[model samples]
Target: MSHKDTIAAIATPPGNGGVGIVRISGGQLESVARGLLGRDLPQPRIAQYSSFIDAHNNTIDTGLALYFPAPHSFTGENILELQAHGGAVILGLLLERALQLGCRQARAGEFSERAFLNGKLDLVQAEAIADLISSSSARGARAAQRSLSGVFSARVNALVAEITSIRVFVEAAIDFPEEEIDFLADSDIQQRLQQVIDDIETLIVEAHQGRLLRDGIELAIVGRPNAGKSSLLNALAGDELAIVTDIPGTTRDVVRQQILIDGLPVFVADTAGLRESEDVIEAEGVRRALQIQEKADLVLLVLDASTETPENLPVIPDPKRTIIVWNKQDLVAGEMPLAITKGLDSVIISIHNTSGLDVLKQKIRQHAGLNEASEGVFSARARHLDALHRSEKLCRHGLAQLQDFSAPELLAEDLRQAQQVLAEITGQFSSDDLLGEIFSSFCIGK
Candidate 1:
């Protein structure tokens, strides 16, 4: 529970490999290292060939021992890393030996949590460390690295500095009520506020792209029975993940697939065909399909172009988030119907022939705002976006108060709230519960 507790864990992954690492961190690391190495702690930051010993002075393994002193280590504490033959049993014995030497087993993410608490890294950077380790693509890893290097934190800190300055000015003006200088009505202050708002808007857009790269997007494919929903899923996923048949309701459950588009993951769920059914199981599948459609970031309404015109369809998807996919276009007699395409984004595709699938994929990427150049994007999480949105809303509300009501006090309060909300992104303002929830997702030994 406390940073003073010397913690140790097997840093390497499970199973046998070429080498394994047992990491230790705490104020007591110096003596612990001496106990394990059977001699004085090695020169700081240098790897020394030594024998890892057990409690009875028996050599457990012969490998390299690396020591890092306090104030310059990853966790801002004395640290030791033991590199030995990478076998599950060997690593376990080494970790057990450290526990015998006054070190407790580290919980998941305890090391990075310590780094955050010790000021060596902020919450964003600490989270980025985990993100980097779990990244699925090179681009995602680069984005996480950008966040870890303080790119995102620097932008947030800049916003906080500006807001703090404005708050100080407004509070100062409120204190001097007798002054004729109308600071609240000053055009310069309003312009500065507006500029900050614009910057936040821009940051929000970039963070959204970063989030897509990190968490990806959920796409639900839904439509009436026998509309080639499973065919489209197979085409997109490049595998026969779902059964494609002429029979209606062939897919009685949702079939999920992970499709990568230029390093961005797309979790595509091919849900059961939506239609009225007498069978209880088929009806349940239809109900679950609707639920997935509602929750998905984008819904693909696959329509059978060969059967009927687009206007005659009984159900219409939410135009804002749904893409009308007119499938089986190869069977259509003439050019596609132009009606019912005015409001929503629709595409003509032949899943059987694999036509227009590229366009569909591009539309998906565009919907996620990831079709653009992603250079310099810093990875972001849902919480970061939520905080940014809340902060932006508060700033907008404060601007309204200043402009419409000329209420400096209300505007000042709004600014304070906005500042605090922004601070949460970097852990400047965070509760213990939030910290625990965030770090607990990280793998142990991080």
Candidate 2:
């Protein structure tokens, strides 16, 4: 775990490829490279062709050797990369040779961990590396790239700078009581505090969108028997993911499918129809349907327009997060029922005709808080949102203390707390445990 110890790992994936790399990073990289390459360090940042040698001077594999001197490498330490034939056994032998040369195998994310410890990268950027690698969509990859390039960090640092200035001003007012200046009531102080609050609000909104893009949404399609729930799922996914039939309870279990809606992944689960049935299998399906509904981020209540009346519409849980979709629009002879509207977002769509599905998708996208414009979107995690929310709460509480209680001291302390919470986002103030939990999720030799 200590950065002082040299670490080496096969940087390539665990399969045979055209080329494989063994990455070494630490202070002792120079000696390790000499032992493996049997030559003086290659020119810095230059890929020199060389033959890797064993302890007995036996030629292992001839490829390119790259060297990055300390303070300029990915880990802010001396780094050596050996490019050899990508056979699994060859890469393993190369890694083993480095281990014999006094290098230990790197733990998961050790490279990025070293970079973070050495001030080469902030916590957000360090996390962005993994996000970028695992992004499923093009937009997601672009957003993660922005975060890795420090766009997200810049926003967080700007807020931290503002908070620092406020603390200094407030503390200064408290320190000099002889001036008899009511700093808490001063219009300038109020304006500055309000501006900071406003800025934090904006950041929170953007961070929310980033989180949705990173984590996506969980959507469950639930309704009574023969309500075209399976049809809607197929339409959204643009594939035959679920079996459709005229027989009730055709889908006896939950069928899951993932679809990208404008770069945001939506995990759609088509659950069995919700109805009371004496059959054991059907009844279990109904139970599971209710369970999925409780855990889903958004629920689509599909109702057959021809058979379902407004008065018979099932009571939905969490009406705000639920969308009522009246399906089979073509079957209904006259105007559709409008009485079921309970302020919930409702759409009338004929899954057979492929009509109104776009509106349904738009509603789902709105649920995720992602607009058509993807500008300024960055990769974020749940922890970032949590920190932002706590910071905002502290700022609001501090403002309340200053305005209502006229307690400048209390306001200053709240501001400090807010500052600390925001610092956690950028790793300025973080615990070893939090750092371990975060980086451990990353792949080794990151």
TM-score of each: 0.96, 0.96
Off by over 4 Å in 2: none
**What does each candidate score in C-alpha RMSD?**
1.7, 1.5
lDDT of 2 by residue, 32-104 (tens): 8789999888999999999999889998899999999989999999999999999889988899999999999
- The alpha-carbon deviation from the true structure for residue 144 of candidate 1, after best TM-score superposition, in angstroms, is 0.9
Report the CA-based lDDT of candidate 1 relative to the real structure. 0.90
The alpha-carbon deviation from the true structure for residue 5 of candidate 2, after best TM-score superposition, in angstroms, is 0.8
Model 2: pairs clashing at backbone N, Cα or C within 3 Å: none
User: In model 1, which regions exceed 4 Å deviation?
Assistant: 310-314, 338-342
lDDT of each: 0.90, 0.90
RMSD to native, candidate 2: 1.5
Candidate 1 structure, TM-score to reference:
0.96
For candidate 1, lDDT tens digit of each residue in 1-446?
A: 67789999999999999999999999887778778998988999888999999889999899999989888999998889999999999899999888988899999999999999999999999999999999888889999999999999999999999999999988988988887668765788888889889999999988988899999989999988899999999999999899999998999888999888888989999988887889999999999999899899999999888885555574766777889898999988887764756567988899878899989988988887894688989999999999999999999999999999999899899999999999999999999999999999999999
